[model samples]
Target: MIYADNAATTKISDKAFEKMLPFLQEQYGNASSQYSLGIKAKRAVEQARKQVAEAIGAQPAEITFTSGGSEANNWVLQGVTKLFKGEDIHIITSSIEHHSVLNVCRALETENIKVTYLQVNKNGLVLVDDVISAVKPNTKFVSIMLANNEIGTIQPIAEIGKYLHGKGILFHTDAVQAVGHIPVDINKLHVDFLSASAHKFNGAKGTGFLYKSASVDLPNLVFGGKQEHGYRAGTENVAGIVAAGYAIEENVKEMRKTAERLQAMVQTTVSEIRERIPDVWINGNAELRLPGTVNLGFNGVSGESLMNILDLKGVCVSTSSACNSGNDEPSHVLLALGVSEEQAKSAIRISYGKYNTIEEAEYVASAICDAYSKIKSAI
Candidate 1:
């Protein structure tokens, strides 16, 4: 099948898989133990931590491994809330954040924590001014995503981080969709916390990292073992961590070239689709979007129906965020961008990856055009 749903998850790289094999086989040992084998495992985990930290321009001690992006996001938010006491904790986030962030904010609301869900512009770009205006004396944290998962709009994270730094509020970014696919420098972004998932970057699932700036102090979420320097507690997934580190190392070495190729493919596909299908609306900021993502809406055509037809033709696409695929509700991101309910329901997200070729993109675009034609005729 032609897999165009890379935003959800990319296939694990062969290099990462090779690095994981030894850990899964003979190198299996609890990282918390002090025995010879355990010490070896512990060293491996530390080495992986160093590699991950280097990728994000963070210190080795600042990186905390977690189950995935969701856990990392939750840990940061919970840690912030715990450390701030009952000082009317407030959080600033966009309306299009992943459910991981949105649900956490909803739960925080029940605890009397104030939250401001900032609106996005027509291009799905969150305004830095809106963020500044939303901050109040009680605003303790600002959590925004570096790149949107559904529409691929890249946020002004560095700008927002600089603004929040002087306000004494902690800044966190969900970089799950941006880590390996784009350049991410923690120091440059000036973010206190950043979340990334391994599966999003051609690595094994069940492994991710949260980058916490050394300057920011927060409480530990898991309070058991001393794994991750007592910041997080759990037996380290040695194999997955090694794989994720190796994946990051390999991808960063060739990110620029890969991104350029994907960008060209996306531009070509968008042009072809617009030419074939009139009234097609491209969602999100056209110029500042991620190289591999294209969200489009075809008037009068349901995204679900088009997706089904494309799937039968061996193409995979998503009608909404992968985290909320089964839900029939319109996309919150699109609505936040001023799209109508009908436009939101007709939107489809197509994200490319390192494995996809220009030929595949062309074919997928053609198939999408065909699918829409068939679905519209049937209606």
Candidate 2:
């Protein structure tokens, strides 16, 4: 099958699997135990933490491993709110955030905490001015995704981070889609917090990390064993963590070459589709998008139907965010970008990865064109 759904998840890399084998079998020990086996596991976890920290330009002590991106996001949001006693808590986020971030903000609303949902422009970008305008006195945090999972829009995170630097408002970005595929430096971005998942970058699932600035005082989201400096609780997934670190290191090592190739393939595919089909719209900022993502809207076809047809042709893709894949609602990101409901419903996202090839991209593009033609002809 031609897999074009890398943004949803990726096949685990062989290097990651190899690194995890020993930990899962021979060195199986709780990271918290004091035995020799446990010490080895503990050492591996710490080393993995350091690797993750270095990948994002953070200090080793600042990294907290979690179950995945959703948990990391929840921890950051709830931790910050709890630290402030849940009173006068206010947050600023974009309308295009994944449901993991949006739903948490929605839950905060029930507690009388105010939230400002910033809207995006025509290119599916949140302007720096819109963010500045949304900031209120009680706004304690700003949560935005570094790269959108569905539309591939890259936010002006460095600009936003600089704006919120000394305002006592923490900046947290969900970098799950941007980590291994793109260059990320916590210091350069000046972000207070960041979240990432392993599966998005060819690592094992159920493993992720949260980066907290040294100065940001955060409360514990999960209260139990002191797995992650008491910030996160539970037994550490040693095997998964090892695999995550290995996957990230390998990806970063080859990122420059892989990214350039994927960008070229995406450009070619999008151009071909638009050339073949009229009234097709590219739905994201062309200049500031992820190297491997192309979200497009066909004027008169349903995205769900298009996805179904593509799957039947052995090409995998998605409509809307994977987190809300089953939901029938029109894409919130597209609506935030000023797209009509009908247009939003007709958009599909094709994201690439290191394993995707030029041939696969061309095949998927042709399949999409064929699907659109058939669907149009049926009407």
Candidate 3:
């Protein structure tokens, strides 16, 4: 099968699975326990923490393990905002953020916390000046995705983070889509917090980490035992995390080469698909997109139907975010870009992984052409 839905999730890598195998069997010990096995598990967790942190240019102490990126994003949004619970506070976020970030912001709004939903351009690009204008006196934080998941629009995180530096307002980024695809340096971005998921790259699912600046402080989201340095309390997933660290490390090591290959595949896929389907339009910023993602709007075609057709033919793609799957609603990301509901409904997301080949890309392009034609003819 040709899997083009890398944005949704990825298969585990050989290196990751190899590193994780022992922990699942012989090393089955609670990291919090005091026995020799437990001590070994704890050490493994710490080593994983250091590996994840080093990959992002963060200190091991500043990184906290979570179930995934969603948890990390939710915890940061709620935890940081809780610090100003009684005060008149505001948050700055874009309308195009993933539901994890968007839902957290919406939840904050219900609590009477002011939230500024920054608008994006037709390319799903949030301008830096718009962010500047949205800042309020009580604006406590800014949460933006480093790269959009649905459309692959790479935001100006560094620019926004630099502008917010020393302004007494914390900055956070949901970097789940960009973490393994690109180089990420917290110091360079000047971000106070960042979220990333291991599954987005090739690590085990249900494993991710949050980067919290040393100067930033917030209450624990999960409280019971002293885990994650009293920041998040839970028995660490020793195996999943060991796999995550090794996976991320391996991904980072090969990112430059893999990214190049993915980009070439994207170029070829887009060119061939658009050539075959003349009315198709590429979504998001053309120059500032992720290396391997392509969100396409097949005019006069149903993305859902197209996805089903592709699936039946041993190819996999997405209509939008996996979280919003089965909802059949227009993508918020597309809507934020001012796309018509009809066009948004026609959008299909295709993301390539390092393992995907140009031959597979050509096959996907051909399948898309067949699916779009067949679907349109029936309509």
Tell me the TM-score of each prediction against the true structure: 0.98, 0.97, 0.98
TM-score between candidate 1 and the true structure: 0.98
Clashes of each: 0, 0, 0
Worst 10 residues of 1 by lDDT: 225-234
Model 3 stretches astray by more than 4 angstroms: none
Q: Which segments of model 1 are wrong by more than 4 Å?
A: none
Residues 248-319 of candidate 1 have per-residue lDDT tens digits of 988888899999999988988888898899789899988898899999999998999989999999999999
Residue pairs in candidate 3 whose N, alpha carbon or C atoms collide under 3 angstroms: none
Residue 337 lDDT (model 1): 88
Writing each residue's lDDT as its tens digit, candidate 3 over 272-363 gives: 98787777898888778999999999888888999999999999999999989989779999998888999999989999997899999989
Candidate 2 accuracy as lDDT: 0.91
- State the RMSD for candidate 3: 0.9
Model 3 TM-score?
0.98
Worst ten in a row by lDDT for model 2: 78-87
